[model samples]
Target: MLQLKLYYHAKPYLPWRFRMATRRFFAKRKRIRYSGSWPIDPPSGAVPDDWRGWPNGADFAFVLSHDVETQIGYNKLDELLEVEKQLGFRSVINFIPEGEYSVSERRIQELIERGFEVGVHGLYHDGKLYNNRATFESRAKRINRYLKQWGATGFRSPLMHHRLDWLHSLDIAYDSSTFDTDPFEPQPDGLGTIFPLWVERKIANPESLTANQENQISDRRSAISGGKSKKPNGYVELPYTLPQDSTLFLLLRESSNAIWKEKTAWIARQGGMVFLNTHPDYMDFKGNGNASSFPISYYADFLQHVKESYGGQYWHATPDRVASYFVGCGDR
Candidate 1:
């Protein structure tokens, strides 16, 4: 954790090119070490024990999501949205509530109006939210406020740092902060399952409400007063099954999206979720900047592949819908 703090704290001081080169060097070593489990971990293909398959009899589920980290990334949302819209896909757009840029309510409403789900990425993109229990509890209040203001129920923490048990404080339907298998993140622990898992909220004392609970009491008096509200039903943990774009393009320096296609096929064969989390920050629509961006066509081509290769065989839903369905499916 201390190492993570130092890395994120010093991130601004380090040159972007230096960080990219350093990460690439370490990623090369990790690729060789975790070749068997990464990208397509055969062990992670096992379906949940009580799985009843996707709704509408679809063979598998596909979800798309993005974590906008900076102003540059936020500016590219329109372009990215157009690409997905043209491909007949929509995704959750998570924005940092108090990051380097300011997101207006108008933009949030526009995204919600366009069939894209809005979610709180984090208060800030820094890696300090989980430094300790007290810090998380404090920040969870602010995160919940943004969730309510944006009318969103999904969240994905910056840099994928997470503590699922502690996230119960936030008023979220699901969290995409974990992945099935990725040894490249600061917190590289994988849940080892491709399916969404139920994380029941902890029973809290009415007399001793946590920061988030106290903040929501006005809007949810009955639930907090007697602890009978369905909000306590807990949130879903949606771990991205596909390798991230930055991981493939920047760190590993892949020229194409073959790994995404290969892993999508494998997950589909296993009847698991083909959940993908990309970043608008790393997508190069201009077809340049290899240091931090990949050709946008790589993502476009992958979407087309999914549509053409397995048309009508997969259920494409947003992360929030997936969480609601999982909870409403009577599986819990």
Candidate 2:
């Protein structure tokens, strides 16, 4: 039925009706499985045995991210760097290659020199990457190539739009596109909470082009590692555990940083990862050409809170470092 529906939907683009008919004929044939489940392995990477030492021995990590668009001019970047320096925190900035604002190679290199991590934020800021496989793959490859040039190994699909099945093709070390939103989970039983999980792709056929190609992506859904324990995949999935700054400030009509502070404290206590997302276009003092006054003081004060509250124990690192450390790619 699934194949039949796919064929019907694709019929109009084919040159002949027989193409549809042929697909219909084969659609009824179900592939047999020797093993019901694919063989999956626990993450052999260096994951923390316990998450209790972060933020003053509380066992949580705060991953701050910025989605930088073209509209955000250089002035905003300068302000952001100042705020970061004041807080003693470094963040990952995901730059869209084809957006209202483009991040230059020099700027990206500068960020790296300053202990910040650069990441891919899609070729364009359009929200259509997850609509299909072909387009998504092409865009992913382009973004991946650019990231490699910039010395980045992580990705966050635009707007958090993701097709989990297609993510394996990107060749990124880790993905931060998953979230705990109630409406998005595939299975009825949620991943339970907004914790980071491993997303493993199961290659149903070793010989096919897509086989051994990371097809069956699963995370926090079942047991693995000889059934002694259940684990996510080799690819770490750092989900957005809290509302983005845009959602809180604009969508929720919030003018103060109180909401963010409250949520940060809550996630810290849970010993889980606190993934905070913001946009340079929104936070920029010059409005990044978007015309809104930059909230520099508010952002700085927020960072000050984290610095004072967490003290030196908080791992003030970038998202790339977090991903690398989680996957055992970098030194802890």
Candidate 3:
């Protein structure tokens, strides 16, 4: 069936009650297989005991990324940057080149200047980028142009509306548009692994890609061409791990960082990637409320938990650095 990409952003503007009612409707269906909620080793299995930690002997890995969707969010970047910097953390900030926010070269440079990573969020972020083949083909060219202009090698589809086969055409190195366990996204399909994956001609199926669990992630990285040669043209895909604020703190109207803490531990135990996408637009400065209504210091607390629990055990790096680490392993 053709996926009718209704205005994807319309849900956020929905009446509060309607949003809650809809959440009630799909809550159970979304968890049928525990797709986005469960880690690589669900009840049916266990993480391979031979699992190795991240490079540098770090216990696990975490990558923080943000998608700038609105002007308020763009303006909120300074505050977020201050928080991350003050805490000794660096994150990749993705910007929409076109759409409600007009990202200028100056804004791009600001991110670059601050020692942060810059990534390309979809050109328009309108949810229609992949309504069909021709539409994506048309937009893909502009997206590539923006990639070069903005000097971005990472991409996260607007609202996470991704068509992997079509997305492969872009010359980016990695994409964080997929998830390991997320039920609230516009397109909620979990690729079933918590590590970076090679999305290319060789990787034709998700299960086959991860079914060989032993050395699964390392094996996949070895096959990535990263656009260096025509023999196997493809990109690495880093699955976003934690639930977005819109889904957890807003639509579901939860009030705590319990989920973040839980998932962080699971990813660590599995010794997998902990890539997260928390939008600045959805944050709540106040520390109390429906939580879904606001971030309310939830993000900060989550970071603190990571530092306290794992401390030097986890490799806290951006997605680009992780990608490089994987590629570097392959080169060795």
Against the unseen true structure, what C-alpha lDDT does each candidate score? 0.86, 0.59, 0.72
Candidate 3 TM-score over all chains jointly:
0.82
lDDT comparing candidate 3 with the true structure: 0.72
- Give stretches of model 3 more than 4 Å off: 1-3, 6-20, 28-53, 202-232, 286-292
Residue pairs with backbone overlap in model 2: 51-59, 52-59, 70-100, 70-101, 71-101, 198-233, 285-294
Report lDDT (Cα) of residue 35, candidate 2. Answer: 17
Greater TM-score among 1 and 3 belongs to 1
- Ranking of predictions according to lDDT: 1, 3, 2
Q: Which ten residues in a row have the lowest lDDT in candidate 3?
A: 223-232
Best by lDDT: 1
lDDT of 1 by residue, 85-110 (tens): 99999999999999888989999999
Which lDDT tens digits does candidate 3 get at residues 1-332? Answer: 14434445465577867756877578656655565345333531234343444788876788899999888788788888788887788899998888687888888887888879899998886678887788888888898899878877788998787788877657576888898766566676777777777666445454554434424333333434343322233567888877777777666556787878887787777677787788887675544454335863788888777777787888888777777666544422
Better of 2 and 3 by lDDT: 3
Residue pairs in collision within model 1: none
